[model samples]
Target: MNGTPIRLRELAPDGGGQLSKAEQIAQLRAQLAELDGGAAQEQIGGEGVVPLGGELANVLPNGGLPRRQVTQVSDTPSLIVEILRQVTEAGGYVGVVGWPELSYAELSAQALRRTVAVPEPGLDAVHAAGVLAEGLDVVVLHARSEIQFTPAQARPLLARVRAGGAAMLCVNVAVPSPALRMSADIARFHGIGRGRGCIAGIDLEVSAHAKGWKRPPALLTLGSATGGVTRLKAVPS
Candidate 1:
C-alpha cells in the first residue's frame, strides 16, 4: 500500500489527549514508509551478468555501467570505483547501499557534489529499490543487503532511463532482471601481487561489450596514467 495519508486532525491530540486510532495508524504508516525509504521494488529479471549500453565507454566493454540493476564484480571494486566516479563527475548525488563493505571516505574522492550514506543496511533490496526510486543519482548495493528478483521492481527504472526522464542510478550486488544486461564500454579490472615490502605490477584487464565494440577484453600491466596499462591482451569470446 502507498504511504498512509496524513490528514489535518492527526496533527493534534484528541479529546482523550492522545492520537485517535486513525491518527495512530497514519503515524505508523508514515514511520514505516520513512524506514522503508519511500517505495517498493518491482520484479523483472533473472541471473547471469551481461553488459549494458556504453556509458562508461572509456572504462568497460559495453561502454556503460550496468543500468537499472545490480552489477557484480569479482575484485578490487573496480567497476564501482570507475562507474560511480563517472556518475558523480557528471554532476549527480551518489548513495552507497552497503556501508560496511566499502571504504566510503576513500571513495568519496569520486563524488563531485555530495555523497549520502544509507544509515541502515538492514532493509531488504525491494525496500531499498523503493528508497532509490524516490530520488538518487546512484545507489551501490554491496554484499550486505537482502536482494530479490521482481519484474516491476526493475522495469520502470529501465523505462525511465530509456525515456531520459529519470536521473537516478541504482546498483545491486545480487542478481538482476533477465531482460536487462549491461555491456561494458571500456571497463578496467586490475590486480597486482607484491611482497609486503616491494611493489610488483598491476595487471589490468579491459573489456568492450558494446554491439559495435569489436575489440575483445584486454589484460595489461600498469605503471602510471601515461605508461601504465601496457601489454593489452584480447579476451576470446
Candidate 2:
C-alpha cells in the first residue's frame, strides 16, 4: 500500500434523479468491475499480502492476510486490534468503524497517525467501509447490532474491496462469504493477584481454515502489558 490516497468517484443517477439503495449498490459493483477490467479473478493476486506477524502468519494459505478479500474474525475480538496494530506498525493505513470502545492509546504514535476511526458508523456503514477501502490498506468494520444485510447489500461491498485491493476485517458480521475465517476456541487471562495483581496476559487457542485448507490450530499467548503475542509449541496429538 502506497502512502498516497486513492479517492473513489461517486456515481450519479441517470437524468439527475436519485437512485435507490439497491440501485446505488449495483452501480458501485458495476463501476468496480469495470475498474478491474471486468475480471475480479485478476485481483486475487494483484496486491501484496499483509503479514500478520509471528506464527499467526503461518495460519493463512498466503502466509499473510490477503488484500482484495474479506476475512472474518470471530470468538476473539482482540485479534482484530492485533491485526490493525500490525498493519499500522508496518506503515499501512487502516480505517476502523463502529468500534468506539477500542483503546486507541495503546497503539503506537506512528500507527495512530496512519489510522482513521469512525466511532458511530450508522446505516451507511458498508458505504463508509467501501469508501475507506479505496485508499486504506485495511478497513475494520464492526457491524452494528441493528444492521442486517441481505446478500444483495453485501455483494457490492465485497466487490469494492476486491477492486480496491484492500482487506476488510469484519467483526461480528457476515460478509456475502468470507475468503478466510479465524476463530478462537479458547481465551483465558492469567496472572491474577489477590488484591491488586494486574492481568499478566492471555492464552488463546485459535484456528484458521480457509476454503480448502486442512491445517491444525495455532496456540497463542498475548501479553497485556506489552501487547506482544507468542506462539506456543504444539502439543502431541
Candidate 3:
C-alpha cells in the first residue's frame, strides 16, 4: 500500500488486551509523582520535618512538625508563637487567621514582617486561611470561640495545605481529626513575687499525642518570660 500505516493499540505484557493491576498501579504512581514535581520532590527541610529546635524537637515523635499535616494546639498562645518562631526563623512565611491580638513585639522583626494576619471570624476566617495556604509556608487559624470546623469544611483547607507543602497550626480549634494534638497546662510561675516584683516567667506542662506515635504522651516543660519562650525540657512520665 502507498498510504501511511495506522497505529495499533499496545499489547499487554501477559498478552491480554488490558494492563495488569500491578502495572496499572505503577503507571498511576508515576503519573502522581510527575504531578508532584518529579522524583526529587521538595521538602520543608529535605526530610519533610520542620525543626522546632532544642528541647521542643525532643517532644515530638519526629523531632519536628511534619509539613503538609494539621497540628492542633490548645489555647496556649505562647506555645503557638514558639512554633511559629522556628518556622519564621527558617525563612518561612506565616499566616495568622483571626488572631489580631498577637503581640508583635514578642516576635522577631523578620518574623513579624513575614506574617499575614486575618482578624475576621466565621466563614470569612476559613476563606482567609484557604487563601493564605496557597502561598504561605505556615498557616495558623485561630478559631477562638467563634469558629469550629466539621470534616467536610476542613478537608479542602487541609488539601490546600498539602498541595502547597505548608504546615497548618490550628489554635483553640479542634480539627476534624488531627495528626497531632498538643495541649499545655500551667505548672508553676518562676519569677512572680507576692505583689511587689513584676511577673517574670511561668512554667508550662505541655503534652502531645499523635495518631501513629506508639509512645506514651510526650510531656514537656515550656517556660515563658516576658511573652517569650525561654526554655524547653522533656519531662519523664
lDDT by residue (72-185, candidate 2, tens digit) is 877355667677777777667677766766665446766766666655544466776786677667888786453445788888888778777678888777866688888775
| lDDT winner | 2
lDDT of 1 by residue, 1-237 (tens): 013221111123335565554544454335434422532221111111122223224335334444444444433454455545545555544455444444433234435233444433332433343444344445555544345546666565345433321223333433443322333333432333353433334445554333444455554443343243234445554
Off by over 4 Å in 1: 1-62, 66-76, 105-113, 145-173, 176-201, 206-215, 218-237
State which candidate, 1 or 3, has the greater lDDT.
3
Worst 10 residues of 1 by lDDT: 42-51
Q: What is the C-alpha lDDT of each candidate?
A: 0.40, 0.65, 0.62
TM-score of 2: 0.73
Which ranges in model 2 have alpha carbons more than 4 Å from their true place? 1-46, 146-148, 193-196, 224-237
The better-scoring model by TM-score among 1 and 3 is 3
Quick one: ranking by TM-score, best first? 2, 3, 1
* Off by more than 4 A, model 3: 1-44, 121-123, 214-229
Estimate, for each residue in 37-134, the C-alpha lDDT of model 3 and write its tens digit.
43224335544666677666766768777667888888788677767777777766666777766654456766665565555433345545665565
List TM-scores for all candidates, in order: 0.47, 0.73, 0.71
